[model samples]
Target: MLATPPDFDVLIVGAGISGIGMAAHLEMMCPNRSYGIVERRADIGGTWDLFKYPGIRSDSDMHTLGFVFEPWKHEKSIADGPAILDYLNRIADERGIRDHIRFGHKVVLADFRPDEARWHVTVELEDGERKLLTANFLYLGSGYYDYDDPYDAGFDFSEFEGQVIHPQFWPEDLDYTGKKVVVVGSGATAVTIVPSMAEKAAHVTMLQRTPTWMFSRPARDAIANFLRKILPEKVAYAITRFKNIRMQDFTFKTARDKPQKVKDALHKRISKTMGNDFDLKDFTPPYNPWEQRLCLVPDDDLFESIKAKKASVVTGHIDKFEAGGVRLKSGELLEANIIVTATGLSLAIAGKIDLRMAGEPVKFDERFYYKGVMFSNLPNLAVVFGYLNASWTLRADINSEFVCRVLNQMEANGSDLATPVLTPEAEAQLEEDDLFDFSSGYIQRGKHIMPKSATAYPWRLNQEYLYDRKVMRKGDILDGVLTFTKAGANAQSPDEQLEAAE
Candidate 1:
């Protein structure tokens, strides 16, 4: 029998924003390297397409959230779900990138063969057929949320006669117009729906156990609009992108450094906006800002809705679900015709794919991450997970460019494998904690299975975007931290080969 060639040089496990961006970057920098995107969903947009809840939009503005290579031409900085999906589709279609995507391929197994320096991937198609693909490198651009299972919040939905809806699987014909609505949770999803539903619903109430940090900004970027009219399109985008990034970074840094000052400033804004009638305590979060992702309200829509008497906020524990509505622990009942559980997402790591090396199973929990991208001692793979504190695409963009640099470096050095080996000293100094460092329910719920971050650089989950950009931009492939092994190095064991990466 004739020998067969590997499917592609690089296998990207998602066709979402990061995957598409990865494809674009690969084509731009390493044209000779062949790659294909395998997406489980039939469509292009990942989360944007997956979610159909009313009032769904981005918490982060489009200037920094948009891809570095592409300019978001839309007027709204906080665009709706459909607009974002459309933007993603437009990039894929216009760039002719859709041709390389293999839809309906769900990766179930990814095993690294150290002997051949390749990955043997097992994919399951929608039609129930299983197939195998081989590649020199694997890139996980698949977003982290679990599609099949959203967080349940442990509510007895059977007791409630009212309509209970999860944001991920919003019903097509469930009309909430002229109905009393209560949105559960105080995160981005709940806030987004509270304002949008307030426009149609008779009255909407946001129910939360604790308050969340909220910030308001105009939906449209005045400077960006003015710049577009005067400056070149790309130039305007660059300026706007830089300005937003710097401002966002400053706010986050200030919060971390002088939390009490930031807290006071936030109280001032809330007090000024809501006036004396509204209780400011209901808006004040207990924890310091940036401990969890802050909620963004565009153009003060949520506040305006509250001011117009279209919506209200209720902070209490749910005693139980009654036939009429949710009963609070204080013996008060809030009547609601529709209950929206904007609860939270169920976070899963590595897409539940059983990753192995040389037939030996790999346990992610036992290892610390390498530069927040590659797993410790895992060879030839990188997972792109962005910062919760910043626009996800910021890290994704830098990650794609970083991958391209690694591939080019490998080709130049005639190397076939690159792995992040935990040195004896690094291992001794390793500190095991939650990878996210977040207090959100989703992060708390999934911390056990998540990987750990070390106490030092090239191992810690660097949450700061500007710092990460500078670090990853250096493209130090042989920084003595990440290891690379040569092709057909049979004389050495896998452990020895990994240490010989440089």
Candidate 2:
């Protein structure tokens, strides 16, 4: 039996940070409009709520990760996962966004009916039932990570007798205490898991295919904390934010200009910290700094654990999984009771949405990206992407603001639909190689799905706050290939008219 169809002004998929932010903005912009956010999980916080692995934390500072309207009150800039999740949950509850979210409701497919000018959304309920919804607009706030499966690198684990766990699918009942744990992969998650598990486990071994460029920074900024005690909260946050931004900017510039110098400096730092115990060459990646990603070690804890003989790093290729352990290509078998695969996430663009326009299929591969906001030839759809250089929320904030402006403009112009259309020549000018060179699955999947821009600043993901403010906030919202379709002409209903006006 088909469940009762609920009609809404807007239907938002994924009740994560982006979805919550979008809901809040939509509510503020059009208070009378009826909207609903659907999430597959029982609660909010998306990835934060999903992952329960030890030592999970934000890669970026708390200030950057947090929403602009709500400042993070925590003293530590680099916060752990539980704290971040709490902050998100608090935001959802405080803003009354929890009511708008329909948990355990996963959107299966969304089809736009041009004649009706509404999106026919199909969702699966928790009770093995299917429900249909119709909305004038559809907004996807699902982040880039693949939530369906934990990243296991094509390893035939059938031969291995040890228990295997992916951090994404971490079991609540499983205990790692006194067990020899082997964490496979070289990334932020692996780096974090090794040190944290070493505290409880008998031994922790971090096996990596290649050494990641690792850098050490204190989890709690002592100077910032001192300043906070003396200065106002806002002032302290500003100072720390500026300091972090400038440091990141300098590092990015150095890596781009003098790659060898950055590598040499990093090599020296790692050697100085580890002395004879750590193998510097084995841990250093051959690629340029930031080519993959620089692993941030909190307070040299990973190294400290290695020095104490509780943890160790092994750099080699895994031949296969043996009965009791991993067999490396170098003919060495490392025994372990448990194996953790921190390989990486499989990227799904717009969370694998099937898009159609005017009853014709729209291939994302043939399309072009407009300022990273709108895809060419797409109508009334905008994808929110964050800055690669700065905090994810910084860019997300601007995107939200820009979306508000566009919405306001549409209302004022009495338009029912707006589509950004790019020229064929302009679209062809984009270079694929320079766009997303990252070897990760997310970047690889985005090659056809995401916008391909060569430059970083202004055109691409320039992390500069001032530049983004000017281009995204101050720039004209309807300047480019935006085609505005007036109401009634596109067969929009009276209800949609009332909703749009609201």
The root-mean-square deviation over C-alpha atoms between each candidate and the true structure, in angstroms, is: 2.2, 4.3
lDDT of each: 0.87, 0.75
Query: Any residue pairs clashing in model 2, and if so which?
Result: none
Global fold similarity of model 1 (TM-score) = 0.96
Q: RMSD (Cα, Å) of candidate 1?
A: 2.2
Candidate with the greatest lDDT versus the true structure: 1
Taking all chains together, the TM-score of candidate 2 against the true structure is 0.89
lDDT of 2 at 283: 74
User: After superposition, which runs of candidate 1 have C-alpha atoms over 4 Å from their true positions?
Assistant: 1-3, 431-434, 493-502
What TM-score do all the candidates reach, one by one?
Answer: 0.96, 0.89
Clashing pairs in 1: 484-501
Model 1, backbone clash pairs (residues 3+ apart or across chains), number: 1
| Candidate 2 regions with alpha-carbon error over 4 angstroms | 1-6, 27-34, 276-278, 425-433, 445-466, 487-502
Which candidate number has the best TM-score? 1
